[model samples]
Target chain A: MTGPLLPDLDRPKAFAAPWEAQAFALVVKLHERGLFEWPEFAARLSAEIHAHPDQPYYVSWHEAAVELLVDKGLMEAGAFLDQARAVVRFRASDHHHVARLTPIAVDPARAG
Target chain B: MAGQHDDHDHDDHSHGDHSHEGHDHDHFHRIHSEEVDALLMSIADIEISARVKALEELLTQKGLVDPSALDAVVDLYENQIGPKNGARVIARAWADPVYKAWLLADPNAAIADLGFAGAQGENMVALENTADVHNVVVCTLCSCYPWPVLGLPPVWYKSMPYRTRIVRDPRSVLAEFGTVLPDSTEIRVWDSNSEVRYLVVPRRPEGTEGLDEAALAALVSRDSMIGVTEALSPEPA
Candidate 1:
């Protein structure tokens, strides 16, 4: 934890919510995968601190997690860019399947 | 949990109102929530074992495609892809206004430009976040989403609670994600009952001023696309 600081759990319930749990999960997984050892994760946090010295000290843990993963090659850096291009190819007719269910028929004869 | 889905068992929870089996089973192929829950259990077993012994037997009996290949594809779709594409779309919308407009109007064309084509994401919409009003996307049933943009619904986003609550009480829902909006903020509740899922192109923060497009794009998080939160200020590296 070389980052400026960890998130404060005492601030509000939102800060301690489950959303952060998933973000933390990615951090733990990144660590387990050997993408960045403890020292490297600490170094990345340190770097973020040097860079954003003045910003509020909140949720940087999650940002550091994403940055460390991208920096350590665990996750694709172009993930967001790729998603933008993917959202453009929309079709009007596809809205019909929004509530569509798998077609599984039960014959009237099968009714008990 | 199966028979419970037939009726609103958790009415006090506010989310139990959206009934998945509201239709008459006579005209429908009704699979109760319990049945789906069992199917999910089987799927989990197959997924965890990697062997999928029952799947293999069924495939052998019904002459289905290579079971291994099918599982691999399912794994790729379920695990590998989804949120990444969503981030990409959000980044682009942040960078280009015209492109963002096009994305809002016709999301499929915008996404195709990035070489991602799919059945679920064909009719897409990009809902941009403003300071006053915010938008969050969710599927009321199972986790149907614009996976081509978003990689996958985060576990929290896919919860029965989130799906049912977000539509009725978006302000409160966003609060759980640490997003607080003033009473003036008009939350557009996009009922994604159809496959036209939505992504929130969060407004770029101020500290990131003068940063280039690439730098700005880096700050937009996956949760921002789902409209739970806004993008953070882009920190200098």
Candidate 2:
């Protein structure tokens, strides 16, 4: 018996994950704000595609935005990554996360 | 094991031994037993997602970014702009001969005239499919699609397989997409770049000459405008 004709697809959002949606929106928003040009993002994205051809399009696209942000000196590489680690920890441990909408305990680590 | 986080208002959905010390990360306090596994994203997706989320929160806190503006961008792409815009264009081209000629001659102005223009869609070239010829568009280097009309391209469209294969042997590629055309039809594959985006105006399906623009627009699927498939034929009378 066949499982189904077509692969199951999520109908709502284009990106694979919720973060991809935010990442996409952020890059477009940043470009609109003139922090960097579309071509600048495009160039980085093109290079990223070549660098990691196997990775998903948006994953590379997200990295391209991060690299561009760091390149333009608008964002610091170290702090940004550190915050990302903090966020991962926060999401996992914090009870008030999207998993539970109760008043969040800012995990002092992430708060600062 | 589940009693550690008794502080949270566990709504009595159900519970499991989901919260052990090492696995504290699965802090879905009140979630059902069945939902625990479903709620946990793949480790890779979770990592990248967390990183991007971190970037967004940090930027917002620094006042370097406006959360509302990000909201606006997501909302626009998610809802307002998509292939429906392109379908309308294709439908117009089919219904109005004058617009078809104008779209073929100058797509940017013709497309922008319909208010579907900006960003990746600023430079537009409308490729028309005819009885003797067929047109298909691809961005070989990356997923450079026409956003205003096509919206964000589908997952398969951006995949390496589709990008590489579509250009090499479009007939086989189109066949895989269930777009079988006659052997006599000349298939033209157009490579899209950042400079110029291509929107294929598929041949209108036979019958239903009486159908108005809105009805015709409804028949134009996203893939049809992309040239991967032909427009849907009107249902039996």
Candidate 3:
């Protein structure tokens, strides 16, 4: 409250997407569980943001979480990178193109 | 969970999109395959679920994180705590005139008396919406919100568009949210910071004069508490 004030922004909602919420929840839970302190997380997040200036804010947050997890030795760097790659591959090769189908009406008359 | 190696080169894409235009340091550059680039793009664009699931599994497997504990935290925000807590406070203020006076005079102590004091709500300020005055809350720098009373913020509240545009043009922003106030009604926006957070106590809607405190509390919406919209009028029972 005492620092230089930032311009007031319209806070329409808390989370823009599910990933943002997950990222937020992960950070808070990790802090609560003593994985890292809030200030540490904030510093990592600031560093992440500094590194990737153009990326969305939450993406930077996600990267910071990854970096902190790796730095703390709580998560393996190679394993995380591998998992991230695997997830990317899964989406690219198997999941991405699956078309969503609308539910078929049980009765023709019921179909609108 | 360590030894299996995929022949794919994961190290190539270590530097995804580091535009070092402002920085004057020479950083190592790694050559990336087109396939790896495409995969990274997909992960960044639309595969957040996959990435999140993978991260969660990795942490859980390492015994560093507990899934139930994470769920408990999310559930606490999503359910146990929320604007309903704020609604109760607002309803009490509306029901009791002396309490309303006290709330306006000293919101921090008033809110704590109602058992809604902790975390981001350590310093509280209640802005009352009257016939000619409306109050809205926003945090421009980061999403510093009243967690004790309002729970986790919605996605849009922390968005870049909202953060940049709200102060410059609040009426337009409120209009986008379908909140059209009269020109005669002066709009006041409260900027929330780490030290002080704000709660908008909307004017009680007309009708339902016989409604009890519980009923009044039930009518309070999260948007109304944020001052984006007004409380809903009573529906025919």
lDDT (0 to 1) per candidate = 0.48, 0.64, 0.60
What proportion of the real contacts between chains A and B does each prediction keep?
Answer: 0.03, 0.25, 0.15
DockQ of 1: 0.03
Task: Give the least accurate 10-residue stretch of model 3 chain A, judged by summed lDDT.
Answer: A98-107
Per-residue C-alpha lDDT of model 3 across residues B1-237, encoded as one tens digit per residue: 111111111111111222101010011112233555454543344244445656766776676667556555555556423445788888888899998998988988788889865452136778888877778876654555675677666556665588667766777788899888777677777766545667899999888689999999888888788887898789987
Indicate which candidate wins on lDDT. 2
lDDT of 2 by residue, B1-237 (tens): 221221111101001212211122354445553344344333233346556666887787777788666655655665433546888888899999999999999998888889865452136778888887788877655555666576656556656688778877788888998998777777877766545677899888899699999999999988887888998999978
Displacement of residue A21 (Cα, Å) in model 1 is 20
How many angstroms is residue B175 displaced in model 1 relative to the true structure, after the best TM-score fit? 1.0
Ranking by lDDT: 2, 3, 1
Q: Which ten residues in a row have the lowest lDDT in candidate 3 chain B?
A: B19-28
TM-score of chain A of 3: 0.67
Candidate 2 clash pair list? none
What candidate 2 gets wrong by more than 4 Å, as runs, is A1-78, A81-112, B1-83
lDDT of 2 at B48: 61
For candidate 3, the share of real interface contacts preserved is 0.15
**Predicted structure with the largest DockQ when compared to the true one:** 2
Better of 1 and 3 by TM-score: 3
